[model samples]
Target: MVKVATTPLDRTRVARAALKLLNETGLEGLSLRAIAKELDVKAPALYWHFKDKQALLDEMATEMLRRMNEELAADEQPDTEWPDALSAALRGLRRHLLMYRDGAKVYSGTRFTDMSYAAPMEAHLRMLTGGGFTPGAAARAWLTGYSYTIGYVIEEQSMGPDPVKEEGGYDLAARAERLAAYPLAAAAGDEMFRDYDAGFEKGLAAVVAGIGATMRDAPGA
Candidate 1:
């Protein structure tokens, strides 16, 4: 694909260009100068739009959140049960993060610079609270799930082509053999490095179920 020689630089343009730079050079190699070159603009000119690399990164993060909010807004089923709603929301987040190169790292490392960016978060809080969860419980419920998904994706992206195992990564067979003294945990050797999708779903369900239980058992519940 032919990249545009130069962009009519703006926050959105700069941020998108930086994401392109990220695709070419990872987070370690990404720099303001690199993005500036991608935009066909001078390094100093980039400062006129973004104060620094961090400022550009904040916009990139905002871009991810923007996509997430758009996804949530189009759901048409926001009032669904908290578990389903939470699952959909979290999955949407993961999908958006997985869109760009090193997306999870870019998203997790930068904070939202837009005040309006909190819409989905607020909406989730309301859903939980309406579902019999106390205000605090609602906040914790969403945050716990959100944190887990982001953390999982970050680790997934960091693994490069080999997500579950490196050359010297976890040796399930060796550990299982060594742990033969305890047959139960030892039996989980292959299970440990099995499909991440299945494992993540299980953990997410547990979190959602725990929230429901927590609300049910709450003082006035």
Candidate 2:
């Protein structure tokens, strides 16, 4: 093995190196050994920055979310409506995760390194609450939208290969033949996987609309 001088690693450097490995080998192949190799350090050196692989993964998730928020902020319009801003934020998150192999796998269910995420959280809460949602409804609305985006992307990435390729969609026609006896099930074949982007947008609109509708007549509005 080539022995390169170690540049003194920190949490940011370690998380970045792990993400590089994740893009190349994905989560299944990701390990402290691989990250150490990428960083040109002994595997044990990583333990200084992270207790274990899961800690490193949580940092990666946190970093990914940070970048997502930054990207969204760059393009945010001052006059954008709350619902539009909220939906766009979710879309930005999904786009950011699709950049890596098993990217959503790295994010979902993983913890963040700190509560500095309060900036984005506060922004989202302000949007919902300002739109007439009660405090509880605002929190739930933000959670529901963000959760839907992340959950959908997790499955989207877990599919056979990258969704950016031609192999992204399901063969509803093939499924229809398999479920010939079940009419509704067969009918759903087309709608279920025809267009994920369109589906996500439609679902996000529904969630935002529901939140807006329910909260409109409640205490806030």
Candidate 3:
């Protein structure tokens, strides 16, 4: 019989198996052998598509981005207008990251030097520019908001609560009691620990409004 070519390994399948493993085992437990086992293949099979563990993780991150793209694609009105459309996109992106076990870590570290991520930024820039922001102002606005959102989500997800036991949960009231001298900080202590959605919205709105105000105040703007 003539030699035949077996089906080539698909990176997407490998990535999906890896992400599933991540959800079950956490990031520290991720490994090529684990993913291969998940796929019912040998570890070297993964190497055909990914050079090593890091490469596999990077592809998994890209898969996470693809998930964000799907959400953004589903939004019925992504290009409706300035802040409206851009906010929808950003919210979709953030929500997708929050869905995974360690979504923020995957997004921040992935060398997504790929067009999928870049195209979104370009679309956002167009939205900002259409909203009367100069090129420099638009760029700065996107960067500031992006940075703040990513940083906030990373911290939030990293410190996500464990439901198995409540013994180690954050003690906002106890801390407030200790910081009596710092009136303002103490007063807002409980507020800071409110639901993540509320906090994320508050911060995002503040940043967007501040950026708009600054752009309007600029000379000739």
Best by the TM-score measure: 2
C-alpha TM-scores of all predictions: 0.79, 0.86, 0.80
Give the candidate number with the greatest lDDT.
Answer: 2
Poorest stretch of ten by lDDT in candidate 1: 160-169
Clashes of each: 0, 0, 0
**Residue-wise C-alpha lDDT for candidate 2, range 47-67, written one tens digit per residue:** 988898889889999988777
**Candidate 3 segments exceeding 4 Å error:** 1-8, 76-79, 162-188, 216-221
Point out the higher-scoring one by lDDT: 1 or 2. 2
- Model 3: lDDT equals 0.74
Rank the candidate models, highest lDDT first: 2, 1, 3
Model 3 C-alpha lDDT per residue in residues 53-163, reported as the tens digit of each score: 778778888888777776676664654856666566667767877776666776675676256777767877777777788888888988887788788877776654532
Candidate 1, residues 1-221, lDDT tens digits: the string is 98867446788888887877777677888998888787778899888978877888899999767766776698749548777888888888887776766788888767788875676778888877777788888888887888989887776566434322333345677888899999989987556455656866887788778767765334335
lDDT at 168 for candidate 3?
Answer: 45
